[model samples]
Target: MAVRQVIFAALGVSVLALGACSGDGDPILMHAGAQNRGPDEFAILPTKPLELPDDLAALPAPNPGGANRVDPQPRADVARALGGNPAAAVSPGAMDGGIVNYASRFGRNADIRAQLAAEDLAHRQRNRGRLLERVFAVNVYHSAYEHMWLDKYSELERWRRAGARTPSAPPRELLDN
Candidate 1:
């Protein structure tokens, strides 16, 4: 009876050890919810409207590498829509001095974008799922970030209870859906 009890205890301990080895906690996903799909439809831009030239011989020589007269100029279009000089869109220095000053008030890091991209890649790789999850190519991004998920309605209620005003927040009843 004593020998049998010892065997059972050892078996239980081994089972727990195996279970612990099954995974590292909080699995991350490499691409989040990204799916393999066709090219984005919004990326295709329409060419500028066609217009007949005043003189056939007066037309400038075509340079494939250079900007075309009929090329879509979205910045110019936006400037025109806002009743500003369309030509201003071509000049980098045409931006308002006050706006530029305010935007650069905090010191800028030129390589910040590259640094962030590298750091994000490292984080995803470091937390990239368990052995079985990685082997089966399972997505665990949402589950991994579950702690960061916000319940907006509950948060608003808590804030209101604490006497904080939320003028633009929707009613709690509307947030049920």
Candidate 2:
């Protein structure tokens, strides 16, 4: 009975050890909810439209560690906790009861990613990589953003735009062409 109990404990310990080695050795993503990007809340300093009173003596007594009244209300609860009426403090245009202005961008970029992807595909097609560029891959992207100094394609494009004119058609381009 003692031997059996000892064997069971040894088996359990070995199983737990094997479980630890099962990982792929990659860093475990802690903040998967944020797509591993972590929090961006502290990225930019939050500002409010509110201004302080000019009269230094008329100002309210400052607490030991009170939040600034001039600070933007990040949320309705925060505004309420700071002793400010959210309904009155928030502007008429402010949605979500005077929280962050992030709500104003709601539905604004619904199809923007898809549209940008399509545009990217078109841009890549228009500027297809050569054999050397295909090997490197970086040069293709580098040329995409660079200025048209000594452009080889512009000359080719100029030929495509130059059509067979019927009886002296001197091109007056830009909308009239």
Candidate 3:
């Protein structure tokens, strides 16, 4: 009778343990003493397709020309009156009823040319800044790596002098392993 009771108690405890381990349908499992082969061996299944929001479906396509495509005639007139174009015979820096003839020698609007020049200058300035930043970053990284290599070599020499087992070759960690 006592043996029967012990068996029943053990069975009850095992049943509770199994119940506690019930999962929410995740399929992967790992066991002790198993080597992790890498991401390819233990990857999760692909997820369901994502649904785009309803409001995004109604959004209009963007205009390819952007905002700068609008006519700047009024601004061009102001530029022309400023003596930007000699052929127009408009006095320099003079505002003729807010309609300046900003025409250039090439017959192009001076205001448009000025706007393009400003944009070009800004683009070149940004590129220069980016180039300088990259150069500085590369120099810093090179210097840091040089210092680290020197420090590692010095430590290796110290170990050798202390009669420690000097490897026939440098340590694997020291190589690009």
Candidate 4:
């Protein structure tokens, strides 16, 4: 009886330990590990209502590859709903010219997003876990970036010691006497 009770207790503790290690850590870093539970709410969008024209013959000839009359135009619809010019929203270059020009003044790489995504994927792959960790599907994101971690409070104190103004920084924690 005593031997059986000890065995059961050890088994219970081992099960709990295994359960603790099986969790998906830091969802932002484990996007690839995310399971699809249901349909994405944002992907389901309502189409524009169908409208009958008073003069049917006045409509342009239907082009097989052209935009449909009832197709959802989210940007234009949003602009129109807000009493703004829908035409301006539909044509990108026509509106916000000054802002766009200022932002791209230093020159712009059209494939910047794609380039960055490739670079990030390469970085993550390079910093991936060891054979055992990979086999077990354990996340190593935090450990991989451990060396790059900054000590913000120490940095604030260092700047203060150097006579740099740190007006925005909160007062340092009070040390007990």
Please list the residue runs of candidate 2 whose C-alpha ends up more than 4 Å from where it truly belongs after superposition. Answer: 1-73, 77-83, 86-113, 128-130, 147-177
| Residue pairs with backbone overlap in model 4 | none
For model 2, the local distance difference test gives 0.61
Which run of 10 residues does model 1 get worst, by summed lDDT? 23-32
Candidate 2 residue-wise lDDT, 1-177, digit = tens? 999999999999898667655544224342121235555787776676677679978988878777777665566556788897775665446545445356655645668799999997898778867865554332355466455446644544565578634333333463244
| Full-model lDDT for every candidate | 0.77, 0.61, 0.55, 0.79
User: Taking the tens digit of each residue's C-alpha lDDT, what string does model 4 give over 74-154?
Assistant: 788899899999767755565679889999999999999999999878977998989867766677876676788898878
Residue-level lDDT tens digits of model 1 in 71-91: 888889899999999887865
TM-score for candidate 1, please give it.
0.52
Candidate with more favorable, higher TM-score: 3 or 4: 4
Report residue 120 deviation for candidate 2 (angstroms).
Answer: 1.9
RMSD per model, one decimal = 9.2, 19.5, 27.8, 7.9
**Candidate 3: residue 46 lDDT (0-100):** 41
On a 0 to 100 scale, what is the lDDT of residue 53 in model 3? 54
Q: After superposition, how far is residue 100 of candidate 1 from its true place, in Å?
A: 5.6
* Each prediction's number of clashing residue pairs: 0, 0, 9, 0
**Worst 10 contiguous positions by lDDT, candidate 3:** 24-33
lDDT of 2 at 74: 62
